[model samples]
Target: VIGVKRRVHGGLRFTIPVSPFDRIRALKQECDRLVAQAPPDLPVLFEQVLRFERMIAASGVDSVPSHADGLASNILIGPDGRIELVDFDGAGNVDPYYEIGILINEVFEDEKDFLPALEMFEGTPRPASLRRARLYAIADDLAWGLWGLVMDATSQRKDVEFYRYGFWRFIRCRAALERVDFGSYARML
Candidate 1:
């Protein structure tokens, strides 16, 4: 299958979404903002996952350039059924399997529910990649959780809805954290 990789000839005028590791502090600030706005009874699970992600960041990985923003909104389908990827704003050096986790978590309700996304990429995903995807999926949860908070903080038009969305994302992130087999994945490394 053929793929298109766009090349930029000069310095970009617009901002790009930095890779997750680089954006950790900003993301955490957003997470903190969300927590501050939330009630006292909010679950600690989101915090737990965020802390774990911080640990992962310090340990580090060899950055392989790939799309950091893989939300369903960025993908475009042609009339002839061909696929076109639109957003490169968040494309940069990061984990190779990064998008899989984002794609799986964003597009599916269950970890076991893998289909069109699983089929979208070439070859059956390996155990290592799947495991990494699971781990990264947890991270994606935190990212989206923070995103909701930003929306909640910024949007006047969707104030109530954004608050609900922010809290919901936190809850969702916590659930994904609970589902991760930390012990099993740790052993894999």
Candidate 2:
């Protein structure tokens, strides 16, 4: 048997007052802004995003799936900047790309810089990392979307705009998921 003790008092936590739902709402709004700004006939970009999502889902091998709760907030960074993961509450049965995608989303909000982070995370040009990151990013969107819904259900309608944002995120996530390359990722699972 193994036992782990809490290292720092209270451990790592964000100072941001926004709940997970608020963050998701913000992300959805940002996605909408980006999509609205895209060229009217940007099918190529959309196709590329789909291909990337497919690749990300396919990155992991069977038997050693990735951690499900790979969010940056769950990671504890020491004074020396080394990372220690906390709260494996959602652990197990995930693709390896899950962590990679989460990390990419946290550090690089800009789509342009996302590729570089993707390259570093995958450690190889598998092309699947792109798809995985996209999927993970969409997952982030979904997470926030649900968060907003939960807040609304709990009667926190003070932030109605957040719920609207969540709806937008859900729509965007669905759009992206529909184009994902499920075959590649499913084969590994």
Candidate 3:
């Protein structure tokens, strides 16, 4: 057999220099734009947004360097089983729980897996953090659902099912919010 050599590429830095406050403001603006463009009948979306805003305002957790967007499409797994992340345009110092929340929301479909997934991330899961992550997931879904709506209206690419994507996100968000545990999450915070 001929000798073969393999090389693994080093992990790519998925961050660009950005001020945390500036990034926060930009995120808010983007969310606002999406909300404005979205149809107005979404009470659940509005409630989630308000709670999220309050949560951010009152959060005791310090911001840390992390990926601001956790869409699975931004992550890549190499044939060699190496993982890399892309899309640093939104990278900045943000609440680490928010980062983990986005990742957990994207990675897990069953709500039952949320606490266990948190354990995977934190080594030992903390209930408060789990609650925070859940809240963030709700907000993330709402924001992305609105984004889908806005994109459907503005995007010239009619081939893409933007409305369907948004509707699904909204359904997920609303379902999560309407669950019995949702209030428990809010009260725990």
Candidate 4:
């Protein structure tokens, strides 16, 4: 078949649909932004983002409808355990692992919990997918970190510490990027 389409839930809002390439390009643009307190390894981080973009292009994975910003703040769990999703501003079709990666990164603070949680999501753990998820998480951090910096620089709101939040994300991204197995993960992809 030349193409395939899957019907998504009616409630899902993909009004701002975007391709993974769009996301990558946006990240690249964000990297060009000047931040006085930017991470010391900004150059390396930029390089990694480009490398992952290439890997993703070569993967030939089909994009699926996803609430691209699957951060914890957008999720709500009722007392009966019914899960509800909100904030579709960034909803779009993206690599399935991007969605999974966001969830794994947000829900599991400890790296040790990532694999088991991934297993629960996939019904069986696939190391390669995990690597992809981890890489996606790093990309997420860089994207949001840059976003925070922009917001901090421009927003008049004093209620939020946008700069601090952005720097924190940069720190997280740096840590994950520096992991000893990070190279192996990239190679596996």
Number of the top lDDT candidate: 4
Q: Which residues of candidate 3, in runs, are more than 4 Å off?
A: 1-40, 180-183
Name the regions of candidate 1 deviating beyond 4 angstroms. 1-18, 31-36, 39-43, 50-60, 115-124
Worst 10 residues of 1 by lDDT: 1-10
Error of 2 at 70 (Å): 3.5
Clashes of each: 0, 6, 0, 0
Off by over 4 Å in 4: 1-21, 27-36, 180-183
Q: What's the TM-score of every candidate structure? A: 0.73, 0.50, 0.76, 0.83
Which parts of model 2 are misplaced by more than 4 Å?
A: 1-65, 155-189
Q: After superposition, how far is residue 30 of candidate 4 from its true place, in Å?
A: 5.1
RMSD of each: 4.8, 10.8, 6.9, 5.0
Model 2 lDDT tens row, 61-176: 42222334545677777899766767765444334455555556555655567677656554563555565556667666576555554554444468476557656656665665
In candidate 1 the C-alpha lDDT for residue 130 amounts to 67
- Residues 75-182 of candidate 4 have per-residue lDDT tens digits of 777899766677877777677677777777878888889888777666797878888888788888877787787777677997999988888988888888877364
Clashes by residue pair, model 1: none
Overall lDDT per candidate, in order of appearance: 0.59, 0.50, 0.66, 0.71
- Pairwise lDDT winner, candidates 2 and 3: 3
Writing each residue's lDDT as its tens digit, candidate 3 over 50-161 gives 6665665565665556666678898777899677777867776566677777778888898788888778666798888888887778778777776777777678999999
Instruction: Write down the worst ten-residue block by lDDT for model 4.
Output: 1-10
Give lDDT: candidate 3, residue 133.
Answer: 80
